[model samples]
Target: MGISKHSIETLKQTLDILDVIGSVVELKKSGSNYVACCPFHDEKTPSFVVSPVKGFYHCYGCGVGGDAIKFLMEYEKLSFVESVEKIAAIMNFTLEYETSYEKKPDFALLDEVMRFYQKNLLNHKPSLDYLASRCVANSSIEKFALGYCGASFETIKFLNAKGLNKTEALEYGVIGKDSVWEYARFSDRIIFPIHSPSGKVVGFGGRTMSGANAKYINSPQSKIFNKSKLLYGYYIAKDKIYKQKKIIVCEGYLDVIMLHQAGFDYAVATLGTALTKDHLPLLAKGEPKVILSYDGDKAGINAAFKAAKILAASGKDGGVVIFANGMDPADMVANKQINELSDMFANPVPFVDFILQHIAKNYDLNNPLQKEKALAESTQFLHTLSPVLQEEYKPTLAHLLSLPIHLIGSKRLPQHNPLTFTTPTQEIAESVLIKTLLEKPEWIDFALEYIDISLFVYKRAEFTKLVANEHQDSALIALMINERIRPINDLPSLKEHLRLFITQAYTQILSQIPHYTGMNLQEKSILMKEIKTKILQLKKGELLPYVSSSTF
Candidate 1:
């Protein structure tokens, strides 16, 4: 059964927009509305305005204005259904729906699987013996959710009995569907459950028990699982990551587990996929810095370099952490001096240093031709950085390559401005009008009388309908309802431009209305001419001048 629409609405009614937003953004009272720095963009001034009267928000700086659901969708980067489910849970609302679909696998089954693995570590002889030989501690086993599956397939049978069919369990990569039921996935491996940010078991990754062909196997994509967007151990480490404002990104599950065991709780790793844009934002939530602790192998170094380029492009600080003697983090934790590992983290090297150090190991700068090649490659990489960062690195690269400082500086780079993209006229108008109404509702009646509703396009039609309702609070309330505003998303630039034009038109219409009341027929005609002239001038990029005494 799925949630009902009525229940969803009821949940929304219980949760206030101001309270939800206040949880994330700092808000201060300003007359009847509240103001804060817009969370969706980088800004120094307080441009985000919230109005309890209208039950909506608008950001003058970025032109993002909408109701609570819209806010949740944007703020959390969630799908519409996901946002509704989250808000429904927060409001303690029970959904009512009936469906003929088969019952979905319960989360308790995953819990039981984890419990079985834990019990196996303590009671199962083969599992216990395997951990002892590897020098893996009982405490570490428990911490990493390390467990063993028996020689038999009891775990599979147990899950099957709990409403999970062979196909569904196999979909989650828990068991195989072959007639033998060959313990589908983890035959005898250490299991690691991947959890969503909200703490639901979405998938798993398992390490082989023996020195086998495949080292690791992860769950395939399921309804709730996506490999690119997920990082192993993020749910548990998010708070620490947020507090420390730094995250240690490693290659494998054991590497992350060992780091946590070593008191570096802010470590995370990709789930069988390369670091992506989805991964970048989640890391950005904690801090704008990432340390790539990849293996010392050529593949690992190449992955780290690629990740560094992406992080740098997104305006994040990132670098590679090469192991001292071609060791992975897990091996280092188990075999190397713990103090040596600790010292490396404590005295973290800059990304540039790591890049130069690695290059030095491979290139012979004593040869003039080799030196020139190194300079060109390193200079190209440095050039990709922002102007400010490029300037900072110029002197360092010059000294390292033993080249004239101006050599690198001679290459011109393109400057990036985020605001170069303009918004559509419709969106600009809608946002502008919404902001104006929230600020001064008295102009609503004037706007309704003078502005031609037909002038507005699709989204503008909804706004016009709300205005024509002839009820003050009711019209404002309509703005709080969430619906897909099509064509707006398709043409975002036009939306932004529309908001500006609409806001200016609303202001002009409101101001001109009061002056027209005292004018005779001749005076009214002159006023109309003046208004037309002003509109034409405005279209030509001229500012509106103040009107004093009427010439007529």
Candidate 2:
């Protein structure tokens, strides 16, 4: 059994494909459809088109076309069911799953294991005392579902007797087996159960209270758990993140928990992995600013620097909070330095400024060679910023380097152009047709008569919708007018564009006629004759096509 077809169809019906695609890509209405640079590949000029009427998208450059679900599957790397669940979350739709086929281990079982760990922590006095020494409050412990496991084999026996599958338990990293013995993997350690965004416990993270080889160990990546994608405490911190429009990302689970307890509920942690590209979409939800809270140590500083670059490249606004030597968020809270931590969060250095400071810290300004090297490195990094931001920070960088602002270039350094165009003139013609109907909805019907609907490479759905509604959609018209770089201003402009589009369409079709290697001599001759006649009429200053409908 699989996900119900009805659910997928219902989801497709409720979702606007344009909205989903627009959330990731900066889409502008060029004509009947929305256009943006294809996210599937890097290109400056837009070849991606989203059609709301058709409820799908097509990228002429990369040739990736799909409905909403397909787009999610490719963009987010989610499986079919995962994509459905993601969309369901957006639409607030409840999905019902089939029962006949089972996939992966049961999450319900994982919940029971969590309960066992929690109970075990209660009985373990030394672990509780250790937590207390760290200034972990009882309320915070309960709120975060903190737990522990005993070091004895009896714990495994108890779990086995409770009908836990040995394979499943091992898969979740809850238990381990060796040459002739079965043992609990995380014994004598405090357990932090990792919950999914929906609040179901998917895995556990264990920190050693005693001397262990690794100070921290996490559950292996299972079907339900992905360390790279899961942000610690995200399920709990999401609401606070939305309310504040910011997220505090720290280095460890204890940092996140302590920050929350100290009244900064927006903090979360990475699960033993540095921030990655996969984490961006999760962080970008609700469009919140990010603050990286790391230690002052070299590893921490390097991690913070790397994360800041990722944030900048993704166009996210954020900063950094480097905790002082030998101090982390947990240590700060444990020492009752809540006020100082609050101040650090409040006054985080903006990402660009933080990067600038980080770069300058390595080189002495007194040495000419080092100063020049620092300035060169800073200039190259600053070039990655948006044109507006690059301009905004130029003066600050100049003052820091003790150099004139003009020494740093105002424009972005030229880079190689990787994008190539196909039939540039024809694409422009297709764009004009779409852009005209969008700016002046009233002309949709007139354009429909003279221009074949199939001639539109973008905004075909918008064109179809306008025609169906009898050339009326104030919302669509407003969107087009607001989004256009320069809109059609008057009736004469619209008429002129329509004439140009018709001429270009005939010319493009005529050019492509010979490429129809599949056509016989009679078919080729007939198509060429019709196209030649249309071109002659267009050259004669005919404003409209003689043909009533599209023949191609």
Candidate 3:
């Protein structure tokens, strides 16, 4: 009735769990699995392990383990279907529902129109001259698939000859309803094809060439084209962005094209809008360092300020570079100032520093009321960062406002509850083993088949309640909250631990047989021989079949 099970399974099979997790948290290669500081909890050391082969991630510190869909549901606070919808969007996979689904986009029509525009650009002299004037190299134009659409009649006549449908054209905003071939929507402009991450052209960004007109336009908002979600030139720059581990965010398409031409191929631009929260998913991909390159003008600075807050609050690593004196990346590259541009991009103010500076600049710190206002704003901004980052930047904020470091940080800095973990390692291991069985009740049947509850010497009360599926015991509450105690994460490790417990149980049984009161000597001898044979088989690394019974 919701999402088909087959489609969900297909998504799980095709989805790359690393790429999905890597989008939200920065993962570094360590040995066989990728590791990072657990994003779910505050920790100084990295204990989150992502196993690509197993297609899941486990955080040893916080004990959160799941595949890609489970991760999205937890971190994003989405329902099962919503999480599936998000993964489908990221992977460019279509989700088929049990009843019906949304219609797919008409990419063939877009491709045909894209080719038509490219052909028109080749025959237009002014468009070519405009590119030459902007220092847009021939190679750059070809690489980005930059093209030109012809004048009013010229655009209308072509679609008419191709017999394109009127309704489909109107639905995609390809043309308007008019006497002239439905008013050719992309009339008389230079077009930059906008593509999805997988390099499928989804929409277009059109620029007017007239000296009197310097405005840019986009395809009307449709199911296929969303300006907030799509980044210009991202389809081309993605591979380079992944390789360099960096991405430059600029103001215009020309800035991206010029930056790429100047050897900074890992550059992309917002689609005529400031960066939005929707863009975070794209920025998180590859965990790239986001460099905010904008002009030093008031508008640009304000835009960068908003962008700085978003990036800093979201835990993005990178800086901001202001291109002062009205010169943008396009101008700098055209003027052959590659060295200066390179130096500027190489050194940008860190996000938190930039946010602090921007917040402080708004109020005159010399005034008492303004100084108090600045302190409040700074503290609020500091709360956006992790506790580690907040502490790291406290001194900087304090110095900026000419105040003591004690007055800095949030009104009440977060403090971890004091914990005493004096329990022995054997006790912890037993508690964790019981916790594992408690979390998955179905596994308790298998656990009982192999190991007896009497082995739960350290956590017998907790184990008893766990088997009964009750949670009233105070000891069970402490057991779950103890971060020091963690169950084995993966399947293979769980099997090995269970085998060790089985051997210990057999060993315990062998010693207890001679003390039996109800058994005759002959019966004791038979039980003793059977126990010894089982112990020897276990020593040979043989696995006994676990039976389903109630005789734990």
Give the alpha-carbon lDDT of every model: 0.65, 0.77, 0.80
Best by lDDT: 3
User: What would the C-alpha RMSD of candidate 3 be, to one decimal place?
Assistant: 7.9
Model 2, range 266-335, lDDT digits (tens) per residue? 9999999999876875786567889999989899999999899888866688799998878999999988
Which pairs clash inside model 3? none
lDDT ranking, best first: 3, 2, 1
TM-score per prediction, in order, is 0.63, 0.69, 0.71
Model 3 agreement with the true structure over 204-305: per-residue lDDT tens digits: 888887643547888878766888878898989999999999999999999999999999999999999999877887887777999999989999999999
Rank candidates by TM-score, best first. Answer: 3, 2, 1
| Model 2 misplacement above 4 A | 1-3, 9-63, 72-105, 410-552
RMSD, model 2, all Cα superposed?
Answer: 9.4
What would the TM-score be for candidate 3 when compared with the true structure? 0.71
How much lDDT does candidate 3 score?
0.80
lDDT of 2: 0.77
